[model samples]
Target: METLPKEQLLNSLEHLVDGHLQQAIRHFQNMTAHDLLQPAYNGGWSIAQCLDHLNSYGHYYLPKIQQGIAKNIHLPPKDTFKSSWLGAYFIKMMDPETGKKKYKAFKGHIPAPDLDAYAVVAEFIQQQENLLIYLKEARSTDLNAIRIPISIARFITLKLGDVFQFVIAHNERHIRQAMRNVTDINKRILH
Candidate 1:
């Protein structure tokens, strides 16, 4: 098995986490004031709402990870995956090693929460910042050795390393959603 070198894992995760954050920030930076508030779709979430929803996963679930870490107990994991064409595409896009770890998508699309766009963007940034800090301060050995609190049915024993990967990937998943919101809004404005 090709295990990730300590340096590579650290570098990749740092870059991955920060890069997606930058992507999300830059996406909104160019938006006009009107573009920022556009609904994600007719009768659907606004671009802002979409960010909040996408970010809420981290905000909601990361604390579980902290609780698990603090208590040294396993958390009942919630899958934040979707089953749309985009979800399927990202699954296929993952590196084979990562493909082995993530939870499978549910049969239907996961719904984005309805909320103000500013709230969504703010929460997303907060979650990303928190995760980066947690990961940055923890040791590679701790990450590679900690027993993750995962589900019983999944039959996968997750290491801190695995958990680290999941957090990073999960962040990326939402960043993609945030990006979609931006794209959708821009398309609407141009049309």
Candidate 2:
């Protein structure tokens, strides 16, 4: 992973987090419960399902991040983060902008099809807010020095910076999926 100035990196991350928060709020603001729960097509996930999937990820990653930050609280902050090669690969793979291959959710991360749409949206927004807090905590630590375990394998870990990047990118991907689902539902309803 290439080195980036700390301030620049933090700013970028803040932008990403804030964008998620804003987009989520706007997307769900006026949506009816029916719209939120409606699937795009037969056997497809609803907006609630997309949010639930992201929430499942948050349930795993947020705690790991918090623990890592607490453990590394005494360490001095660094000016740049050197991302792990593996972590970088994961982030690249998950980034929606890359138009890379889609991945199936691990069994544990898959959300139930039946979920309350409002509750799912609320949980997702809360998780995003929590992520913003973690990002702030990260500003005072060496992002590269702190290693967080992957949800898939507790034995393997990635640098904190890479984990954050991966989480943000993943969120963006799913959020976009949820938006697309909403659009498709609306189109079908109109016709």
Candidate 3:
């Protein structure tokens, strides 16, 4: 896929971030504690757990992106961002449309079974807001030059633009997972 122009990329990402925020808030508004905590199937994560997983990622990436933008605030904005080959590959892998590819969660990022649903949902909403801010902040920097270390290996890094793309795509993947969990639970209840 071709890289988007900087303004276009940021605009698209903002729309995605805001849409997810609204959808998640609306979805969780009606969910009871029991509904939120119940797993989709035996041994599977609940909607809350899936969101908590996304929250864990947000916790890591949001700060790194923020710091990169702040440190590079003096740099002039660029018209375009050329994602690194590896960065592009990672973003593609994270895209939900690529089909489901099971990836093991990093040990530290895994959600505990006993998570409070309301709190987890609230945190996810907050993280999405933060992501929106970072996307706006990123417009002023050369996205390709600002590097953020991957959570898997601090030694490995990707450009800020790629990191934003990965994070947004990853969120979409899990939001769909969480929504599916909710649908499954509702179906089982109906049956």
TM-score per model over all chains: 0.63, 0.94, 0.94
Compared with the true structure, what per-residue lDDT tens digits does model 2 show for residues 146-188? 9999999889999999999999999999888888887787788
Ranking by lDDT: 3, 2, 1
Q: Indicate whether candidate 1 or candidate 2 has the larger TM-score.
A: 2
Candidate ordering by TM-score (highest first) = 2, 3, 1
Error of 3 at 68 (Å): 0.6
Give one digit per residue, the lDDT tens place, for model 3 in 68-96. 99999888888898888888899888899
* Least well predicted 10-residue stretch by lDDT in candidate 1: 78-87
Error of 2 at 109 (Å): 1.2
lDDT of 1 at 67: 54
- Candidate 3: worst 10 consecutive residues by lDDT? 97-106
After superposition, candidate 2 runs with Cα above 4 Å error? none
**What is the Cα-based TM-score of model 2?**
0.94
> Which one wins by lDDT: 2 or 3?
3
Which pairs of residues clash in candidate 3, taking residues 3 or more apart in a chain or in different chains?
none
